[model samples]
Target: MSGGVDSAVAAARAVEAGHEVVGVHLALSRMPGTLRTGSRGCCTIEDSMDARRAAAKLGIPFYVWDFSERFRADVVDDFVAEYAAGRTPNPCMRCNERIKFAALLDKALALGFDAVVTGHYAEVRQGPDGVELHRAAAWAKDQSYVLGVLTAEQLAHSWFPLGATPSKAEVRAEAEARGLSVAAKPDSHDICFIPDGDTRGWLASRVGAEEGAILDRSGERIGTHPGAAAFTVGQRKGLNIGYPSPDGRPRFVLEVRPKTNEVVVGPKEALAISELAGARFSWAGAAPADAASGFDCEVQVRAHADPVPATARLEDGELVIRVEEPIEGVAPGQTAVVYVGTRVVGQCTIDRTVSAVPASR
Candidate 1:
């Protein structure tokens, strides 16, 4: 459990269904006794205690598994490396892919557990081939986008007890009715590790900020930058360029070149990516029969971003996606989750992107 209302209600439902449920809280923090700043970070010392109380009320076994080392190596380190390489990564996706499913699930199965149940707002349905991942009843709270990295095996052994819930408020009410202490606990926000929510400052501590040049689309130096890695695609603020365009239009970060320590800026329209591809990817359930060939699918870059109409295909070793409706502010290392209707097909870590706007302008 996450020491939140959603997971507490999920555990209550599982116990009410007469299943032998065990509440496992993962200790992912490297530092001991890390406390939650309001509802910022999760899986802290305070959260573990809350999880224990919820488990006690539900009459289930509770254990705290220390996966701090693995989490640091996989999620935290990878996040820093990606940003240093001028790529934007979603740490939650990496945690779900590597730590939660791969590490936690493997350990659970070895301990004779049938599956890992969580409070994620998603659904797993039994399809003809196997279990398929789908969005929850409430589209606003659907978390299937983040769970897109689960493979067929992972999907088979996963359960989302809060999938059918009408709303988050109802989950809180259920937790209160069950006398769970976490009924009023707020949800975690931003990156859990960075409790303060200052991403650029956090990265600067590790990446080491250095003065660099900011260039325009035509390779003309327009301004100076503190560090190229600190900026992301489509960023307008904190550039410190102090220069307006000839047309008086605000310039947006079009690219970041860590190799040369250069930040490229252009018009906002240039942020739209025509296509993106990645070599590292996995299917949520069964691979599409037409995956190697070509098939139409909806592509989502960010967790809350709207899905766009697209055509995807596996070419050589990469998953190439061409969106009919262009996606803006896309950066390498971000995941592109593909979907067929409400079912999650797969997701890939974006390795490269092609700007929709032509360079001739």
Candidate 2:
């Protein structure tokens, strides 16, 4: 529990369900923690104290385990490198993949705990076939998309006590009815590592500024950008360029060229993509037989984005997804999570893309 209303309510529900429960607050940083009043970032000192208070209220043994080094290396460093490699990265998914499931789960198992529980609003059910991941009862807060990277082993040992709950409002009401002190606390939504939500500035500071030239489709210098790390594939604002296209058309980022220290921009259509490839593949409950074995699935290339119809196949132990409905501005270094109904089938880190071309071209 993070000392927040949702987690507090989750713990309470677990207790009500007559299961043995333990509360763990991850001490992800040695630096001062974040504010419950400030932007919705996690791991602040006040937040930790809040969590401890909630755990105390529940009469459960709560402990804070430090995972600073692991978080920095797995989530932070990976975020920087992904941007430097000209791909947009989702740090939340990275944390969920490496920290929550891998690091924290490993620790829980080593300590003899049968399972670990979190406040994520997603559901798990045991059907005739087997355990399955499902969309939370709350569609608005559904997090199964980000969690699609979990292996079947991890899913089996994990519990999302708040998964079936419908909303933050409902959770808060439960907390209040139960008289938990954290009933009024808000949710944390920003990337925990980039506290201020200024991802470009944070990334530039960590990776060092490398000024770059902005180019058009033909590789002609169109403008200058502050740094290659400061931009993403679909960004339209903050270009800071004064020139207009010869056709007097608006522009959008076409690509980031880290090797050449360049930002590529052009007409909006330049951003459309049809196919994506990913590595570091993780499947929920099954494995693909071969490259020819295709499964109909919904693929999410970005968090909170609408699911796009896609078909996935295995190639060299990687997932290659062909989006049936072409998606615009798909970014590499982000996760491509595949789902069959509510169950997460698999996920991978996008490595390459194929764009849509105009028929006239």
Top lDDT prediction, candidate number: 1
* TM-scores of all candidate predictions against the true structure: 0.97, 0.94
lDDT of 2 by residue, 287-344 (tens): 5444358888888887788888989998776689998878988887878888878777
How far in Å is the alpha carbon of 62 misplaced in model 1? 1.2
The weakest ten consecutive residues by lDDT in model 1 span: 30-39
| Candidate 1, 24-69: lDDT as tens digits | 9998976744334456788877788899999998889999998988
Q: Give every collision pair in model 2.
A: 3-51, 33-44, 33-45, 34-44
Scored against the true structure, residue 165 in model 2 reaches a CA lDDT of 79
Candidate models: Cα lDDT each:
0.90, 0.81
**TM match of model 1 to true structure:** 0.97
- Candidate 1 lDDT for residue 221: 93
What does the lDDT come to for candidate 1?
0.90
Model 1 ranges with Cα > 4 A deviation: 32-36
